[model samples]
Target: MTTKKETRTFNIENLNTRDGGEGESVIGGYAAVFNSPTEIGGGCFTEEIAPGAFSRAIAENSDIRALFNHDWNNVLGRTKSGTLQLSEDERGLKFEVTLPNTSLGRDLKESMQRGDINECSFGFIPTEEHWDYNVEPAKRMILEVDLFEISVVSIPAYEDTEASVIRSKEVNEQVEKRMNLIKKINTTLEAI
Candidate 1:
């Protein structure tokens, strides 16, 4: 009948990677995270390539799209949408998600497309470039772009071991409540 809440607070930091601060949207920008909650561990954050930045990067970086254009009949599309690539070392992974799937979309898919949807590059380089949402590698990176969910645990450096146990109990309780809520909603819908 009683519950305890987590003391941890998540601060979502958003950054533009491709911005030159030139005051022109055409000048473009790259939206990547430079910070994350300390509990996420060191050097971990998410990287969201600006909406058109990936295609633009592919357009500007090289003619990588040209190859796909020729192969797929110019459907080269969003250079990053539904795209994911990992370094040979497997320590980092970069991919694109539909804009509607990310935090910024209000989650609407109508605006989610190759050009408008965000090109996200997620990585887990502990001592390397961290754009928010970066965390340790989850499963091996897949080739196609699809919705993704990753989970990571961070233990405070100064926590008493018992505190972690208590925190864990709170987490489990929260998960159970969410599940129960979903179950109740499903039951109500069935009755309708």
Candidate 2:
């Protein structure tokens, strides 16, 4: 069965350790690691890099406000590192995809395919600034990422929710017909 969208949460304890005390609370604030997002590269763009100009891409995330940057898709020449990201190296061709509908997905696809998308404002938080406590930047580890794709159409609670219900029904019918044909062939073989 296909699983629908669900909200998941994880909690970590003992982040604050008071230098010499039993339970450190002086550090203050909670630090969290998260999965980064990446999108497929369709074309070119102008992004200032350490060396020179570079391309950019974006992907959709479960969190509506959350957005992915091309850095997540870093692979062969894609980034300074020699490691491949979504290419054919890490594991398989694992890449983020936008649903058929939704404004962001629609808009993002247009940019990749046509290079005419709007300026997607995305930035990396210093980590500590977002929290109440002071924590060093670039020292956080990624824990987990919650991935999600948005569809323009809403899923039905029951009955028929899929927009391509007809397609599914047709395929099922085709399978049943193929089974009957196989049964007939087996019967003919037995009689012969």
Leading candidate by lDDT: 1
Give one digit per residue, the lDDT tens place, for model 1 in 1-192. 122211221111221222113321111112222222232212221122122212323333321221110122322123344322211112222222222223332222222222343232221111212121122311111122221121111221312447646655664455446556667887899999
Give the clashing residue pairs of candidate 2, or none.
Answer: 16-24, 17-24, 18-24, 33-143
Candidates in order, TM-scores: namely 0.22, 0.24
TM-score of 1: 0.22
- Number of colliding residue pairs in model 2: 4
Candidate 2 residue-wise lDDT, 82-186, digit = tens: 111221112211222222234544454444345332222222211111111112111122122223311111121112336234533553454446556667887
Q: List the candidate 1 regions with Cα displacement exceeding 4 Å.
A: 1-90, 93-159
Instruction: Report clashes for each candidate as comma-separated counts.
Output: 17, 4
| Cα displacement (Å) at residue 78, model 1 | 38
